[model samples]
Target: MHNIVLFGPPGAGKGTQSQKLIAQYNLVHLSTGDLLRAQITEGTALGLKAKKLMDEGLLVPDEVVIGMIGSALSANQQAAGFIFDGFPRTTAQAESLDRLLAEHHTKVACMIALEVGEEELVKRLLERGKTSGRPDDQDETKIRRRVTVYNTETAQVAGYYAAQHKFHALNGIGNIDDIFAQICLLIDQHKPAVDEAPAAATREVKA
Candidate 1:
């Protein structure tokens, strides 16, 4: 499977890029925000609990987030792969995900970290707010807080995966298509080699 994580801070265009990746690669997109939103729309218990935290601008707890992700994975095991847009924001969440995927015999093939300057991110976020009217982008304070929280919480997970040799940093400043091309290139370069021992053995059999 080609499971991967699209990692980045808020306003890093992760959502936009993930959509492109899903369309181009035919991978399942597992976005934590979408998962929670679905639960909230369906009035699931976990959705109600997460809604409380989100209403207060507080992050949903790790256990709650993990549960949402687990449910998504179980449902998508037959998919070609998954592109995790906004999950595993903490070390604990990362560890839980590792264990969960291990149980399913799937590992993350890569983590593409969309790198952008804070000033640029803030600018884009403010512009998005003007156009999108998202509550989180309504005020500078909330936008800044979201970025701060992302850095404090999610940045470490980048390092954690980097140490595992699965992290690839992609420049996120450019046209949407341009940025996506960078990500595709990185994935191409980092993709693990296919098992060739069997091919070699087949050649020996032919000989």
Candidate 2:
């Protein structure tokens, strides 16, 4: 299995790139943000708890997030691998994810972080906000706060993966296809090779 963590702050084009990677790699895309929203939309017990915390502007607990991921993994047993997005925001969460993947006989092959300048990120997010209808993206103050929160709190997760020699950084600028090509190169390097088919048997006829 060639599991990957697609790491980036807001407006780093993770969503766009993830789609391409999923198509090229045949990997399951697991976005915690999407998973939480699905649960909430379905009114699951876990979703209710998450909704309460989110309604209060508080972050959901890591265990809850881990549980959601576990369920996602269970649901996609035939997947070639997974592209994890918007997850493992802290070192603790990273450790938890490692354990979870180990239970399935796989480990994170690499974590590819999209490095973008704050100015560019701000500009992209503000422009997206015009059409995204996302309140957090629309307000400059919220955008800055989100970036600050990522830097101060979430950026350390990179170190967790780095210590395991699974962290890689990519410049997240210029043409989309160009960036994707670079990303594909890196993934191909880290992804495990597929098993070769067994040689056909040669039969000896008895006279």
TM-score of every model versus the real structure: 0.81, 0.88
Q: TM-score of model 1 relative to the true fold?
A: 0.81
Off by over 4 Å in 1: 43-59, 192-207
| Residue lDDT tens for model 2, 52-138 | 999999989998888888888776666778888877888988999999998987888899988888888999999999999999999
lDDT of 2 at 21: 84
Top candidate on TM-score is: 2
lDDT of each prediction vs. the true structure?
A: 0.76, 0.82
Residue 162 of model 2, lDDT score: 86
Which candidate wins on lDDT?
2
Q: What is the lDDT of residue 12 in candidate 1?
A: 89
